[model samples]
Target: MPFFDHVGPEPDDYDTSPKQDVRLTQLGSASTKTSFTCGDAFGWANRTPGVPDLDSRVALDTSTDLASIPPFLWGLIASYGRHTMPAILHDVRCDASKAAAGNGGRARTAYLRRHADHQFRHTLKAHADQGVVTRYIMWCAVRLFGFRPLGVAVLAGIIVSMLHQSSNVFVSVSDLLNKVTIWPWLSWLDWVPQGIAWGLAQLATALRPNQPYTGIMIAVATISLVALVYRSFERPAAGGPVRFSLPALLSLVGAGVVGVLTAPPVLPLVVVTMVTRFVLWLLDFVMHWLDLAWTKVLRLIDGATPSNVTVPEGAMLPAAVPPFPGFFPTP
Candidate 1:
């Protein structure tokens, strides 16, 4: 039997169609939503063995972020995209499980959390137009952070480690800032953040059992590459976030998984990619600023009307201020 039994033909995979109107609205910055009732009932029952089933419908008032995807990850899998419908169904079912577990004690809560996460995975498989690799990765992320205090802490540490390692990118940004004559203090302070990040990584390592900094670093690199690979397959945006053709998305995601599992030496490659992007970004920033400054100089010269020309009667004159703003001073 199929894993999920829906009430009717499954809802559209995405809301990009003119005819499809998504009913959920974001509630502030958090990935959550205001409660709203559904016009038609959407139901799902698990037929897969060993997996818990909700055995209920989802027509009632629902509040969800559509997906629990973090903001930083929106570029890869947006909170609302092809998987929007499945996420909604999963959210509703997870809520039901949470309510049931409230009175069932800690063990029951843990059990239900697993059930909820598994159901989420199954729903994604059944409804989302996503590859198995993508769906499984998302499910694993959910499962990892579903364990409450410990899981949340670990995830948070991993994020900190990733940011810490990526701090080297900003060293070039600092140098460029110094050269642009913006803020000298910011230029030498790049090491401050790097130092702080190192300290935090140490703290996180101390808290973990095995102090897995190397593993965390490798994981971060792998995830970064996977995101890039998936992003490479993204289709141009029509009205919503960019999406992937099923075939290309599936292929990229599968390749990403295989690469991560088979090739453990990806840290250096990701490091190179990161450094190259940073340097390119710095160059672009410098060029844009130089272009803007040159344009401003030309505008001033153009507006000056040669000193040899007589001013028109009652014509407005230039303000008594520095001609180049921050780069110069008026006497």
Candidate 2:
């Protein structure tokens, strides 16, 4: 039997169904206002060829509803979340294989994998060749000090050199003052003792695991001491007779006083000064060595001849060089 034959002609008249009754309820009325939809929120109708329209529906088609907004709206949302939204979104959409292919990815990946495997094998062989104990020691050194242990060693040398130079200067000055009869009590003389003490304390602090303040003080003091030293030792060039420039001297003194006053403590101040001097000296040495090495290396690599490297024939040497004697073979 057909299902339709079992039912009545009229749906409302069917005996198996409830009686049809029509009723209407009036809803609270709201004032309607016409407004244009934001144009940016819709897809772009016109765009330059080869240029993706940010307003296009395709650009808005993101996996997440949050991301499926118009590009400008998405940018606003993303900016509010921090500019990381673009990167996060890119990551979400990223197919590593596709990305790699864009930049010769296959070749790069193969190269990296090959290099990594070779490195692993080399490391294993190195360990085996060195024996387990030797390898362990090497590993510990690398882990503790890193690949450039020479940097720390260089710093240590600089510190030592600075200490030596300062000590010599202080001793020499003190001896010179003792020999002189007049003007014995100079405030400037106190700088040496204060500076030395400060340097030692700073060094101690830097070596100490728990004391960070020592290092801080050392840095502050060192700066002041260098200024003081420069003012004390600065001299004019040969043609310009040596004379103390009051302005320079006043500036140095002012800076030193301010540094000492604002410094954390006396000990740190001295240490900092000493360390700074050492650093400066080290830097000067490094620069000098680099200059020499660079010149030598360039000459060697560029295949420059010694004759060509000589001072130009017409160029006069500095007056500092001693004059050579004239030929005197007489009959």
What TM-score would every model get versus the actual structure? 0.44, 0.17
Put down candidate 1 lDDT per residue, 127-235, tens digits, no spaces.
Answer: 5657876777677555544434333343444455544555454333434433443245445434433443355446544434334665665665666555433333332
| Best candidate, TM-score | 1
Residue pairs in collision within model 1? none
lDDT of model number 1: 0.47
Worst 10 residues of 2 by lDDT: 33-42
* Positional deviation of residue 181's Cα in model 2 after best superposition, in angstroms: 40
Q: Of the candidates shown, which would achieve the greatest lDDT relative to the real structure?
A: 1
For candidate 2, the per-residue lDDT at 26 reads 27
Clashes of each: 0, 10
Q: Candidate 1, 132: how far from true, in Å?
A: 2.5
